[model samples]
Each structure stands twice: as structure tokens, then as C-alpha cells.
Target: MARVEELLGDELLEAIRGRAAGYDEANSFCHEDLAELQAAGYLKMFVPAEWGGSGYRLQDASRAQLRLATAAPATALAVNMHLVWTGVARVLQARGDQSLEFVLREAGQGEIFGFGVSEAGNDQMLLDSRTVAAPQEGGGYSFTGTKVFTSLSPAWTRLGVFGRDDTGAGPQLVWAFINRQAPGYTIKDDWDTLGMRASQSCTTVLEGVAADPDRVFRKLPVGPNPDALIFGIFATFEVLLASVYAGIGQRAVELAVDAAQRRMSLKTGRSYAQDPDIRRHVAGAALAMDGLYPQLESIARDVDDLADHGSFWFAKLAGVKIRATETARQVVELALRTAGGSAYFRGSELERLYRDVLAGLYHPSDDESAHATIATAWLGPPED
Candidate 1:
């Protein structure tokens, strides 16, 4: 029920949008924006009201993120990792699972959570991991492996990490939280990229970093299975991720429309908005973006309502993420064309968005994986 505009306000978003270009130019983290958001209680948006949080639902959070991304995609993305964890905890609790209650409580207390799921060459995603989760003598586990794209690497106090424990029978996947201050882990300062630079999604190398007893959570068997935690994560992550890119697409179309209305045609001596070709291009981008909002809303609403779509859930989630991201890329390209050479300038917002939207392709459930997942959902598994 909470409105994002009230929580973020026009002034705050304007400041974030102003900083986005500078942060990208310097290849720095959105520390200032994070500070403001933390102060605004944005960090605890998903935490329960009883725990001193806003208690916003997944739909509210998704919509807020979509708006935030329009102002600053990288900041929205940097903060999204934290949102994902808190949202996951919220999802788990909504389903009557109290296992992640501490996550909600801590987030409410102002502790930031970071995403640590991505790894190099581990396309199995949640189903498998290359990180070694060796069980400790008394309890807990020591994780040893490299996790790439650890977003919010600098600001997060707790990082949700997972790994494969071969020491156990048949190799089980160990999910746990690693303290940022934990020993034997290195946060590499190597986040320079084409876009989304403010995220500071650096590489994290864990050399036997310890996860204390109680921190070691799920221990599911390798490969996909029916686990609520997995479902919760997939639902939250994909939806929020989609929302952020959808914001980018929306912003791009807005910029295109503005450019069309403001620029004049020398031959016709009229605004480009009156030009049929320009109007069609802007409309095409707007039309693509128009299709995304309902899909995102429906998906978020389903996650909130816990609608039992059964096996179709994964396909639907993956489809929306791919669609939102791919559509964003298309809309940005269209905007770049409509805005003409001015948009190609280094400091232009459209230019930055053009770069930022490309990062969507690298996220989980990539084109190949998503298409395969969708195909399997409808056509069954491939022939041997």
C-alpha cells in the first residue's frame, strides 16, 4: 500500500539521478545514494511492521524498484541485492516458514544484505556450486571458492552464500550466511565494467571462510528439487530484477518522447513528435514497455498471493525476466536513435541507460537457459 514517491520523494531521486553519471564516470559505488536510501528506511522496505520495517509487499517493492531504476539503474541494482534477500525472507515467512525470520529482523535493524549467488562457470545456479562447503568439527561449515558479481560488496554486513559440500554423502548443497568480517575471504576491487558501475559488484574469493553454526541453513541435495527456499529466491530475484530493467525501458521511452517533442525538423519546420516516422519509433518503444508493466505486476502479485501455478511458475518467472530485460534493451536502442547524436554524448542519461541495460543479458536464467527452461516446461525434457 506504500507509495515509492513518498518514501523516496522527488528531491531524493533527483539527487540520485544527478549522481548516477558521476559515479559511472569515476567507476565508483553509489555510496551517497545508499546512505540516503538507508536513512529513508528503504533498506527495510520488506521487513515486517512488527520488526520496525515498512512491511511492503512484493508488488510494492517491485514497483518501487522499477521507479528507482528509472532514476539510477545501478543504485537500484546495488540496492536490489539487499531487497532480494529481505524479499526472500518475507516470501519464506509468508509461506509459514520461520527459518529466515532473523534475516527480516536484522534487515529491520539496518543491516544490509548482499547477494552472493553468482559464480564463474557455474551455470547450474542454485542447483549446484563449485564452492567447497566443508563441515566444521563441532558444527557449521568452512566455504572455499570464488563468487563473482557479489553486488553491494562494500556495504553489506551479511552476505548470503552457498556451496557444495562433497564431504557429505552424495554431495549436498550448503546454504549459509558469511559475515563480511569473516576471516579468509577477500573482496577484490575489480568491478570496472561497461555499465552498472555504481553497483561495485566485485569478485569475492573465499579461502575457507567460516559460517558459524546456526548460519548454515539449507542442505539440499544437488540438482533442482521442490524447496520453498529455492522457490522463494527464484520468485523474488527474477521479479525484482525484471522490475529494475523495466524501469530502464520506461525511462528510455520517456526520454525518446521528450526528444521527439523538443527537436524540430528543419525541412518541415515542425516538432519531430509530428513526424510520422519519429512518432512510430517512439510509439514502438512505448508499446514494448507497455506490455512489460502488467507482466511484472502479475508476477509480483502471484508471488505475494502464493498462487499455485505449479510447474509453470519457473517458466513464467524466467519468461518475464527475459522479456523485461530484452525489451529494455530494445527500447533503449530506440531511444538512442530518436534522441539522435545528442544521446550518444558521454554524459547523457540515455547514453548511460544504453550501457546499463546491456548488463541484463548476463544475469541468471540467461537467454539460452531461459529458452531451454521454457521449452522443457511446455515440451517436456529432450530425447536421450
Candidate 2:
């Protein structure tokens, strides 16, 4: 299996970086970057080799995402949505569930999958859904609800969505996939944001859109449970999300180093790199990044190896996300301070990174949710 770095060469990254600013300025999707990545077969990184993909393990895929993010955080983030679904399929496959095998096969056939699970104000994070899934005449369901932050909106061929089905024995959460051309579904062009502008993560409105019987993959009771599907989604989503932020921090540190070296001090007749304070700031950011790298890689590897962490898995996954996001924020702040006023410019990479990292706080398992999850795991559930 070829390494991800090898697959995405330096030339490709430079090309992606060259176009990132233009896309951000226009607040559009990274079409050119996606085309290059698609040509390189990046979307199929997690698919099995027999399916004509590189068959990269989760750890390797996360590393590739980190590298990609360093060049263009928005591009990496947009692409991460596709990776999340494919990563979820890989996770399910490892656990002996072939329910999502078609996802892999579809990728091999040039299908692009987009995540459509995030609903506006639905903070329960997959435990609940604002969308309604009404049963059809024969089988399958018609989902009716709006999903926010639908990345790859302009290019996705398939969208993975979930909703509530009250017609069941109880209100069960229905998970399914719908084609982009499915009836009664619309992709709203309302993705203008503070950061990650190039992602084009617009709003997805589903109004009685039908999901084929074969496409309705899972139906489980609401709230926290031990379902493999839930675990797969949580684990893959958190890990990949963290990798992107970590990559942003990594880029910030690199920029900081470069700035410190080139910035000369008139009073001392030397560069900022020779100053103890500047050195300390860069070292601090590097230290924080060093801490996250191991956790990201280790947890991803554990998922790849299917190591059983039981109930602890959720806490660990959430922990890595929180750590990576918070650490990246701090690193970016330090980088900004180290780089001085120049980094505050609109076109500065650090300026973009600062905004991109903030998006991490809005992902599933936010700091508050993650802390509650950890506290509950360590001390049992709160009093009812």
C-alpha cells in the first residue's frame, strides 16, 4: 500500500495551497483542490485495495489529513466529510458489518459521499434528530428535516442522513443514504462564515425525500447506546476532526519558526529566533503539538486494530478531540503573538488558521459535551 504523503506529493499540496486563498476570497468550495485529490484517488484512501483504493489504515488516513490540512485547512476540512463516511464504512467493515460495503464500492466508482447528520440546534449529537423519518408504502423512509454544515454540498453524489421514526415500536433513529438528485431535497447556498470559507458547508433541506429500502441502513432506539454504528461514527468523526485542527497548529508552528528566524531585532542586532522569549513561545506551541500527535495517532490506530476499549472508548475519543482543538487554538494564538501584526492581515495564513480552528469548537462533542461525557463515564450518570 502506498503512503498517503506519497500519493499526495509536494507538487499537489503547493497547487492546493495556491488556490486556497482565491476560494476563500470567493467563499466557494475548493473545486480545483478536490479535482486534484479525486484524480489522485484520495477519496478512496480507506477503501479496501481489492476495491481499487489505497486501503490506508485509519492512522495513516488521519496522518494524510493532517498533512493536507497544513496546506489548506478549508480544503482538508471539506474533504474530511467524505473521509468521515468512508472511515465509518471501514470501521464497520472491521467489526464484521458489511452494511456500508456499498459505500466503498461507490467510492471506487467515483461516488462522493457527504455527511448530512448535523442539524441546527440538535446538540444531542446523533442521540436525537430534528428530522422526521416517515415510513413508506412498502419499505424504506421519507426524511423531512434540514441539516446544517453539509460540507461538499456542491459536489456530493450521496448524502448520509438520519431522522426520527415515531411509527416504530418506539421512536427509533433512522439512518440512511440518499442520492443528491433525490426528490424533495435542496442544498441551500448559505455557507458564508467567519472561517473555513472555502469549505462551502451549506444548509441541506430535506422535505419528504425518499431513501430506498436498501439504503436505510440502521434503526436504533434514541439516546446513548452501545450500537457499533454509533461507535463507528463517533470514533471516526472525532479522530478525523482532531487531525485537521492538529494540522492547523502544525502549520502555525512552522510559520512561527519562519517568522522568528527572519524577523531581526534592531536593539539586539539579531533575529527574533535568537531571543529567549520568542524561542520559548515557539517551543511552547511545539510542545503542545507534540502532545496531540501521539494521542491522535494512537487512538486512530486503536480504532484501526479494533482494540476493545469498551465504555472507555467514547471518553478517549472525546478527550482527543477536545485536547487537539484547544491545543490548536492556543498554538495559533501563540503563533500570532510570535509573528506580530503581520499575521493579522486578511491574507495571512495565520489569520485564516485562527478562523478555521474556531470551527472545531462547533463540531460534535464540543468542550462542554465532552466534559460531561467524561464526567459521566468516570462518576456514573447524574441523578434523574
Candidate 3:
């Protein structure tokens, strides 16, 4: 697989560039394209082995994410969320007796999942969500909440939601693997965005929906100990976001290099590629991306290792997530600066890349809250 990337990098890049214009115009990915991805079995890597997924290591997953992101940001973004949810489900399946057999079977069969963690009220109340899950008469629980920015809203067959229990154990999660044809669920059909427009991250609402007892697994708060299963979900998201930004950076450089070869500045009577300043800027952007790539992978590897070991280090994980997100933002910004004017014009691939890349910084990586946690750890008197 590694050798494949090296051999076909240029071809893959070209295809991504070819689709970039149409993808931007549509402002969302085509279902046919996503269905093709599912058919290729690329979506099954992070799923549990029992479910027919490869269940690769974090390193492999991150690498795959980067490769895909480099080609098509929208596909990468949508698929990454599904991968994270799979990891979350895998952990619950492993630690607890609750069988994810049905959903896992579907996932292995190439069904996609939409995430349901980012609710409008729960965004702030996630740690203490009022979205409670009350026990049904016989089994399962009824769930009600307003979730927003549901990535892959139109494409998924399941939803993994986080909420607190009436028991007051921090937060609990439930997987509502609803058949999309089911009632009591609605897609807002409103995902207009300045960038990453193809993500189609619409708002989703679930009212009076009952999750099967077999489908829902509880992630109760166990004091300071990290919820390894849940942490992987957030950490996976952060890692993928970083990979997307890194890809955008590389794509920017590729665009600039292509432009330089074609268009010449009348003033200097030299191709933009021949300009020393343009060359230097592109080089710098490459260097930044190169430096950050391994760093991002390292963080993801640590998160995965921690999850596997059932360990917790809140501050450290937060720091890693924040660092990767912030670095991705810087990398993409520098890429845009390197590309200059051609990147700013309408219908320019570079401009779209810039917009998609900028979305990374603004996404809820919890930088501020993570920084506070890091400071709290540092300022606390030495632990015994």
C-alpha cells in the first residue's frame, strides 16, 4: 500500500484536481461518488475484525486519511467521521458484553454512519447534557435532542449520540442505528458553508426515538479516568482534521507549481515557476507540511495506544489534539500565502482549498478548553 501511494501519487493528485472544480460547484459530494467509495471497501478499515473490517492501527488509518484528503477533501472529511464512530463502537464492543453484531455486520457490508455528537445545546452541555435517555417500558431508551452540524447527514444509516444519564455519570453514549427509512428523524437540509461545502454537514433532529437495548452502550464517567472508547472518537476526529489540512497544503503547492509552469509574468518575461520567490514560498509550505505530518501521526498513535491500554491522561491528550489542530491551521495558511494571487480568484482550486483548509481551525477541536485543562494540570501542586 505504501509503495502504491508513491507510484501513483501524481495520478491520484490529477484526478483530485480534475474533480475539484465540480465538487466545489456542487457544494457537496455526490452520493454516487460516496457509494463508489463504499463499494471499494475503503470504509471498512477501522471497523472491528469480527465485522469484516481490517481494523488497522492508528498509524495506517492516519496515513489512509492523508492520502484520501490529498485527493478529495470532502470524501476524506465524510469518511473520517465514519471511521471515528467505528472505533468508538469497537471499544464498546470489546469492553462490554453489548453486541454490536448487527451494526458491525452492516458496516462490514459497507454501510456508512453519521455522527450525532455536535448538538446545539449539547455543544455546551455535553459534559452535562440535559438530553437525558429515559428507560422504555420493557427495554431500550427514548432519546430526544437537537443535533447540529451532522457530517454525512444524507449518507449515513446510523447515528452515534452522546448524552448524560439520569444517574449523573458525566456523559453516556447511545448508538441509534436507525434505518434511514424510519420515522421520527429529520434532516434540516441546510448546510451552507463558506468552505468544505461538499461535506453537507446538515443539522439532524431526533424526537421520541427509541434506541434498542442491544444497540446502545453506556460510557459512564468513572471520575478522572479517561473514557478510552469515547476519547478515541474525539482524538480520531482531530487526527483526521489535521490530515485534511496537510493534504490541502500539499494540494496548494501542487497547484502553484502547475500555475508557475503555465503562466508567465509579463514584467519578468519568466514563468511563475521560474521565479525564485515563488519557488521559496512553495518550498517553505512543503517543509511545514512535511514537519507536521509525522507529528500528527505520532499524536494519533499515542491516542490509539492509550485507548487500547485503557489509560487516561486528560491534559496530555488535550494538548496533542490542540497542537495538531493548530499546526494544521498554520500549515494551510502558509500554503495559501505561498500560492499568492492565482489562489484568490473565482473558480480557482487554490481558493477552494484555502476555504476548506481554514475550516480546520474553526472546527471544535476544544483548543481553549484544552488549554485550560493543561494549565490546571501545571498549576496544581505536585501530585503525590
Candidate 4:
């Protein structure tokens, strides 16, 4: 069989490059387009075969996401979150101790799974969530709390929420696949943000909702069984997120090069593309992008190795997240500056790319945690 990258390369690239502008205009992807993604079988790449999915590998999944992000950051950001969540959900479902098959099928079928993990004044951890999951009569629980910055909430069929059990131990994750047509959950529709505006990230409220125990992926104090297996899973997710931003950066450079080729400097009566300054800027941007490719390739290779050998996965995961995070930021910024003030305008592709690339910094790594993880790993055992 062809490698996953070989399978998804051209198609993923075409999808992103073709639809990026429309996604920007819509400020989020429409349901019909999302359904098309499902129909294309792209939505179920991470889903297991038993769930009527291709059971594709994670590396293939990462390459596909990277391709999508390159076309439209918001679409990539919103959909990538669902893809990673689906991957994680499949792992939990495999336990059979926590059967989330019904919802998994929905997610596999391209149902939006808006992440409701970020909370006010709380770091992005399950324990920090204010959403409460209380025991209900019979066997379910009632959930009440607000989540902020959820991507694609306006179009989501379900939301994957993490909160604490009022009486139980540790953190509890609940998959609340509420009806978007219902009033049980309200989308604030107030996600006016500085970056990734097309993501349609909005606040969410879940009230008086009944959740079955079986729907709960795993209780807090989760055993090492799934957690250990999931470490590599999350590592791959980080790679996917960063890769999308890198694609955005790549698009930024492309836009700048295209513009430079057409622009002329009045003073010298020469195409801007021929000017030494423009050449230097574009060269630098390409170099940065080139640097990203090898690193991304290495990350894909390393992740595959970890899955095969299961060693040093956590540390390597942190390193790739950090590298992709910083490089994407630099590459996009270079593209913006190279394009000059015109790139700041609404019509400028670089403007959208600028906003989209910034989203990577706020992803799981966030510099601080990524650095800490690397530092802690480096300082292991205090050197004896």
C-alpha cells in the first residue's frame, strides 16, 4: 500500500489551496462542505475499521491535516481538532470499558467535535474546567458549566468537554453530542478574536444535560493502560497542529512570491522580484520554510518509530511541538513583512495567513510548557 502521505498529498493540498478564500469569507466552514469532507472519507481517517472507517495511520492523518491548514487556517484549525479528538476517542473506545462508539461514529462521519477545554483564568487542563458533572437519578449525570473558545461550535453536533465530577475523583471527560438545533446548549456567537477568526471559536453553555456513565471515556485516576498508549497519540496530535500552521506559513510565502513577481518598483523601474532586498526577504522565508520541512519529516519519522518501539516518545513529541510552533510564527511573519503594508489589507492573503499562523502558538505547547517539558527531560535524575 502507498504511504499515507503519498495517498493524501495532492488531494489535501488542492483542497486547502482551493477553498482557503471561501472559508475566510464564510468566517467558518459550512455544514455542506463539512459533509463533503465526510463523503470523501477524509473525516474518518483516524476511525477504526470496525467503525466503518479506513483505519489509516497517524502519519497519514498528520499530512492530511497539514495540507488542509495550508489552504485555510480556520478550516484546518477547526477540523484538525476534531481529527485529533477522534483519534483519542478511538483509543478510549478500544478499552470497551468506556464505550463511546455511538458518538465515535458521529465524529467519524464528519460531525464537528468542538473542544470545550479552555476555561477562564484556568490553564487548559481537565481539572481546571468549571463545568460540573453531577450524578443523576438512574445512571447518568447532569452537566452545567460554560466553555470558551470552542472551534466550530456554530456547526458542531457534539462537544467533547472535560470537567470535574462533583463527588468523584480526578478529572472527568464527557462527550455531550447535543443537538445544534436544540436549546440545551447555546453558542455565544461572540468569538471576535485577533487570530483564527475564521475558526468561529465561541463560548458555550451546557445546562441540565444527562450523560450516561458508559459515555464517559474513563474516570479520573485513569490507569496507565490507555494513558501510556495515548502519550504517542497526543504527540502525533501536536505534530498535526503545528504542521497546519507551517502550511499556513508556506502559503504566506507563496502569496508574497506571487505578488513580488507582479509588483514593480517605480524608482528603479524593475520588478520587485528582481530587487536584491525583495530577493533576500523571499530567500529567507523560503529557507525558513525549507527548514520546517525536514523537521516535520523528522517528526513524522520519529513518531512512527515511537509507535513501533515506544521509547522517548514524550520528549521527542515536546521538541517537535516547540520547533513547529516557533518556526511557523517566524515564517508567516516574514511573509507579511516581505509583502509590506499591502499585506495587511483585507484583500491580502498574507493578512489571513498572519492571523491563522498565530493560532499555533496558543496550541498545546505554548512555549512555556514545551520548554518546561524539554528542560525537565534534560535535567533527568539531577545527573545522578
User: What is the C-alpha local distance difference test score of each model?
Assistant: 0.93, 0.92, 0.65, 0.66
Better of 1 and 4 by TM-score: 1
Tell me the tens digit of each residue's lDDT in model 3 across 36-62: 556556677766666677666566777
**Cα TM-score per model:** 0.99, 0.99, 0.84, 0.83
**Which regions of candidate 2 deviate over 4 angstroms?**
none
Against the true structure, candidate 4 reaches a TM-score of 0.83
Worst 10 residues of 2 by lDDT: 20-29
Per residue, candidate 2 scores C-alpha lDDT tens digits across 18-92 of: 888888888988999999999998999998889989998889989999999999999999999999999999999
Q: Work out how many backbone clashes candidate 4 has.
A: 1
> What lDDT would candidate 4 get against the real structure?
0.66
How displaced is residue 175 in candidate 1, in Å? 0.5
Q: Per-residue alpha-carbon lDDT of model 4 for 1-384, expressed as tens digits?
A: 334555455665566557666667666544544655666667677676676676765566766776666666777777776776676655455444245566558765556666676777665443345677777666566678887878777666666665556475554544344445545667787877766766677888777665556555544542233353245346657777777777776777787798788788899998989988888888888888787777777766555444443434556676777777678778777777667788888857787777767677777766877676567667653343
Candidate 1 C-alpha lDDT tens digits along 8-100: 888999999999999999999999999999998898999878888889999999989999999999999999999999999999999999898
List the lowest-lDDT window of 10 residues for candidate 4. 221-230
Candidate 3 ranges beyond 4 A from true positions: 1-17, 48-51, 90-103, 121-126, 167-177, 219-225, 260-263, 273-276, 304-317, 381-384
Candidate 2, lDDT over the whole model? 0.92
Model 4: residue 104 alpha-carbon error in angstroms:
4.6
- Per-residue error at 63 for model 4, in Å? 1.1
